[model samples]
Target: MREVFQAELKSIGDELIQMSKLVAEAMERAYASFETADTDIAQEVIAADQRIDYLQNSLDERAIDVLALQGPVASDLRMIVGSLRMSASLERMGDLARHIAQLTRLRYPNQVAPARLVDTFKEMARLDIKIAHKVTQLLETRDLTIASEIIALNTSVDKLHASVFRAVAEAEWAESAPVTADATLTSRYFERYADHGVSVARKVNYLVTGEWDPELSAALDQD
Candidate 1:
């Protein structure tokens, strides 16, 4: 029974890594569609979110079954609980990617970011994609160093997100209201996506260290 329980725990960890890979793919395609105004790729990203959602649900159910049947205690209980939280964050990351793709689809042939802000949004997208990939690596390796890198990238994303709002607020801003709206929303989507990456990283940190870092918690609270 103990061996079977350990196998179940490992399976849950494997599922999390799988979810992280899907999220990374979604963000990559979402950014591609956003940058090029490719509705087809955007549609693909939107469609793929369902699979991410399904994985989250399946992982959660399996977790509950383990809790009910095995009655995990101490560290095992923490792992299962932490898995549930990490899965929730991963699912939210997928939704944020889909939101980016949806915004691209809504704008159609027109680019989402205005010309003045395109570079900024591009940088944000780049960081977000990198963070997603790093998040997958963190989960797979459980390397706290990777988690720290993810948190640092998320900080950069927050700075970019603020810069977008500042640009929109400038009196010299000449973009149409719709363009402004799209820029604001798209910047937010990228920021939140990075934030969720930090969240998963934090959970992984906690699971590995058996204690949450106050500094990481404060970083998230500031956002």
Candidate 2:
């Protein structure tokens, strides 16, 4: 029975790893579409989100089955619960990527962001891609250090988001309201994407250590 349970846990973990990688790829392609006004890439990211959603739903069912049959205790129980929440965070990250892609689709043949802010948006996209990969690593290795690194990376995304707001608010700002709205919303989507990555890492930390990090808890509380 113990051997069977271990196998089941490994299967769920593997699925989680796969989901994170797919989301990371989606983030990459979505940004590429945004940067180059590639409608095809945007549509690919949008279409891929459905697969991530299906994985999350399937993971949830398996997790509940484990809880029902195995009656997991202590860390085993934590792993089950944490996997469910982490899957949720991953799903949300995919949604954010889809939103970015949708923005690209909506403004195809023309850039989604203003000309001046294109570089900043590019940097935001790059950071999210990095964060997504880190989450995938953390899922496999359960390295708490990566979790801290993810939080630090999220801080960078938050700073970039703030810069977008500042640029839009400046007196010298000359972009149209629609352009400004796109910039604001795009920045927001990237920031939220990073936040979900951090959230998943935190859940993994809790699953391993069996105790919540005070800092992570406080940060999540603010969210």
Candidate 3:
């Protein structure tokens, strides 16, 4: 019976890693579509978000089933509970990517960010993709080291987010109102994407250590 329960728990962990990978792919494709205003790729991302949603729902049901049948305790209990939380974070991250893709689709034929700020958006994409990749690694390894890197990468993303707003606030920012709206929203989506990555990393840390870090708790409190 103990072996059966352990196997079930392992299955849940595998599913979580799979979900994380799907979310990361969503971010990458969304960034690519955003850069080129490619509706085809943007549409692909929007559709993929639904798959992430399905995974979240399915995982929650499985976790609940485990609780009801297996009666997991101690670290096993922590793993199930943390999997649920991490799934939520991954789903939200997927939504953020979809939102970014929506901006691209909405402004089809016209670039979203101003030409001058394209490089800035590219940097934002780079940081976001890096964090997303780290999230998958953390899920697989449950290494607190990856969690620390995720937090540090999130800090960089936050700085870039502020820069986006700074450009919008500048006197020389002469883009039209529509372009300004795209810039504002695109920046926000990327920022939130990174935030969700940090949240998932924290959950992984808690799953392994069985103790929540105060810094992660504080960071989540603001969300």
Candidate 4:
């Protein structure tokens, strides 16, 4: 029974890493499409979202199977349950990327944002990718030291989110200016994407160390 449980856990872990990679890539491509104003890239991002959704469902099934058959208890149980939660987070990340892609598709042949803002969006995408990479590392190391750093990184993400939203809230672009709308939506997308990455990290911390930090919620006044 224990061996089966371990195998199941390993399988779930592998899936999480793969899902993380896919979601990160989606964010990259979606934002790249926005940067280049390329409809083809946007369409690709939209289509890839379906695959990410399928992966999330499969992960959920494997997690449920583990819980039912293994009856995972204590830390093992936490790990199994957290897998489902993290899967949801990863799926949401993909959804945000898809939203960006859809925005690109809806507003083609028009500048969606200032050239300067394109750099900003790319920066946000980089942040998303970085956080995903960090979470993957945390999963393997289960190092409390690394987990503590994530809380600080989440702070940086929160600041970026606030800055982006505030900038958009104050801006005024004409209705025909798809660039402004796209910029606003892209900023929001990155914010939500970063939030999901933080969620994944928090779940990992809770599972490995039995401590759930509320850094993200606290940073956003969510609770």
Check candidate 1 and list the clashing pairs: none
The deviation in Å at residue 107 for candidate 2 is 1.0
TM-score of each: 0.97, 0.96, 0.96, 0.87
Residue lDDT tens for model 3, 1-223 = 8898888888888888888899889989999998998999999999989999999999999999999999888878888998998999999999999999998998899889899789988998999889989998998887899998988888888888889888889999999998888888888888888899989988888878878898776654263
Candidate 2, superposed: residue stretches over 4 Å from native? 220-223
The TM-score, computed over Cα atoms with residue i paired to residue i, of candidate 3 is: 0.96
The root-mean-square deviation over C-alpha atoms between each candidate and the true structure, in angstroms, is: 1.0, 1.2, 1.4, 2.6
Q: Mark the regions of model 4 whose C-alpha exceeds 4 Å error after superposition.
A: 165-179, 214-217, 220-223
Question: Higher lDDT: candidate 2 or 4?
Answer: 2
Q: Candidate 1 residues 1-223, lDDT tens each? A: 9999999999999999999999989999999999899999999999999999999999999999999999999989999999999999999999999999999999898888888988998899899889989998998899899988988998899998999888988999999998988888888889888888888888888988989898677657375
lDDT of 2 by residue, 29-143 (tens): 9999999999999999999999999999999999999999999998788888889989999999999999999999998888998888989999999999999999999998988
| lDDT for each residue of candidate 4 in 21-47, tens digit (9 for 90 to 100) | 888788888878877778999999999
Clashes of 3: 0
- State the TM-score for model 1: 0.97
Worst 10 residues of 1 by lDDT: 214-223
Determine the C-alpha RMSD for candidate 1 after optimal superposition of all C-alphas: 1.0
* Most accurate candidate by TM-score: 1
Candidate order, TM-score descending: 1, 2, 3, 4
Residue 100, candidate 2: C-alpha displacement in angstroms: 0.6
Deviation of model 2 at 13, angstroms? 0.6
